[model samples]
Target: MKSLLFVMIAGLASAAMLVSCGGDGSKASASGPFGEIPSLVSDFETFSDAKRAELQGGGEDNMKKILGEMKAAEEKFKESMNAAFEKVKGKEVVTEIDPELPLKVVTPMKIEDISVSRHLVKLVGELELTATAIGFDSYEPTDAFELDDLVVLSYDNNGKPFAYDGLSKDMGGEPMPAGSKVPVDTHIHIESYNAASMGCLSKILITLKGSELYDQAKAAADALKGK
Candidate 1:
């Protein structure tokens, strides 16, 4: 009888220990309500390992050629982004004005001072984008004056920027000039985007005008901690 009681207590303690050890606090074992995707480092390492395997099995010339192509593609992408950036420098637009495209946002930028009206949503913010090309004249600005075309996006707790695909697609072309007052309808839409890419980090803004979509804008702003 004594031995059985001791075993039962030991079993309960072990079970409790296991529950605590395997709780949601452990990243390796903690699955959220939905599981998480692997982090960026895991993705990079996977690609790097595959590339190394190919290099070891193949000729040096092929490896060199592949690297060169990667470099060229990166250069072309940077050039295109720089061209888009150049078109918006020295521009200021009121949120209440017509459909003005939002400015581009790279990493390390903070967004703020957003207001909404019936037909306009005013966004005043700054960005922290690096110069894509060296020879551009606009790159030589003082730190205080560094902000170019300012764009805004609503970010969620996971650091992911969220906006509707339809809205972003609607602003496919060049947006109206900054500060140009144009009458806009409701539906808080995005005014600029890159359609081909997964545009979570792309330049975009959320409008606060229109009738039915007002709540969405407010929700987005609230998600970003706006009062």
Candidate 2:
């Protein structure tokens, strides 16, 4: 279960971030250049509140149900994305599901130095996270969050999932005061490999997690549900 936390989180993220761009570059309503383009992005605030309500209702089954929805959404999203790409480009694209690592944690991350060439994109960035100690008996006062590697995933205007396992030796941070927000630097090098496979960049995603902390958080969540 600990190893699969990210699969669940990424499912939620992917399910959350999918917004419709347009079938073609046309206006939906007649007042503007192409009329008003309709927004396909789901209302996240409302979605989030509903999820919160589910949590408050308190059951492991409820939690499992949400994860089930996320997995279903993931499969559906990938299918729709491939279908759309087939319409735009003639080749079939294969999307990969990242395995849940031993540690599952994601923090607020920002991408910088995003540059694009005919076949590649590169960037420097950092993840904002706090080192935490939980379970009075399990707390360690001097623990530091060690960033071993970065997991990258994203979708284009068409919803195709592009995931890259970004390896970095230059990213990590020193142990800081407990619960202090710190920025751990990282980088990514993504290449489209060919022009036809590459579309305009619509979104970028990064996830980082710690072993002990990830399990700790899950326990807390389960406890909240009275499990």
Candidate 3:
């Protein structure tokens, strides 16, 4: 009887260990290349909740502290995402836009080139604005607009679509007059896990400022799902 009881106790202890290792499905397991993403998201959510609660309590010092914490969390999340992307960096992936749904831009712009990778999509182009579009007769060349002002949409090969609100950086070139075309080199970061999948960026939609085509482009992009 003593031996049997010892055996039963050992079996129960083993089961408990298994349960603890598996957890309660509240946190994601660090398995796949992108597995850390879910945990990062959970952490960010927790941080956001804490920030909101602290703000509600209403203290200037607390607000500053929360803001600093928020910035650090954001940077950490970005670094983690970049690390994940680096894993699949040089993989051969198709970056072809759909021929059926050609890019339609009412504004005067030209996309000369597109380079895609796991982490970023770069667009090399030129943009020319009309006097009417700028609401001015003539204006000197300047960095009058940011790449974030444009509307961009991306679709995976499976037709899963993702939308991006600008988020471009390293846009190089001097600004030109309203009627003169200015060279634009814009790099847009891919933040979504779904958007980072292989063969993503199969379709792309880019519209310039003052184009008034966001709603139409969004509807078309959304329709690509399940196709």
Per-model RMSD to reference: 18.7, 20.2, 14.5
Q: After superposition, how far is residue 127 of candidate 2 from its true place, in Å?
A: 3.0
**How do the candidates rank by TM-score, highest first?**
3, 2, 1
- lDDT for model 2, on a 0 to 1 scale? 0.35
Model 1, 1-227: lDDT tens per residue? 99999999999997754443231222211121101111111222344456667677677798897677545654654454344334433333222211332323222212211211111122233322122211112544432211222223433223334433112111212223333222221222322121111112233344323423434634544443323
Of models 1 and 2, which has the larger lDDT? 2
Clashing pairs in 3: none
**Alpha carbon lDDT of residue 204, candidate 3?**
48
Instruction: TM-score each candidate.
Output: 0.24, 0.30, 0.35
lDDT (C-alpha, whole model) for all candidates: 0.32, 0.35, 0.43
Candidate with better TM-score, 1 vs 3:
3
**Clashes per model (N, Cα, C within 3 A):** 5, 6, 0
Candidate 3 wrong stretches, greater than 4 Å: 1-53, 98-152, 156-160, 164-186, 189-217, 220-227
Off by over 4 Å in 2: 1-120, 133-146, 165-174, 178-197, 208-227
| Candidate 1 regions with alpha-carbon error over 4 angstroms | 1-57, 90-227
> How does model 3 fare in lDDT?
0.43
Q: What would you estimate as the lDDT of candidate 1?
A: 0.32
**Greater-lDDT candidate between 1 and 3:** 3
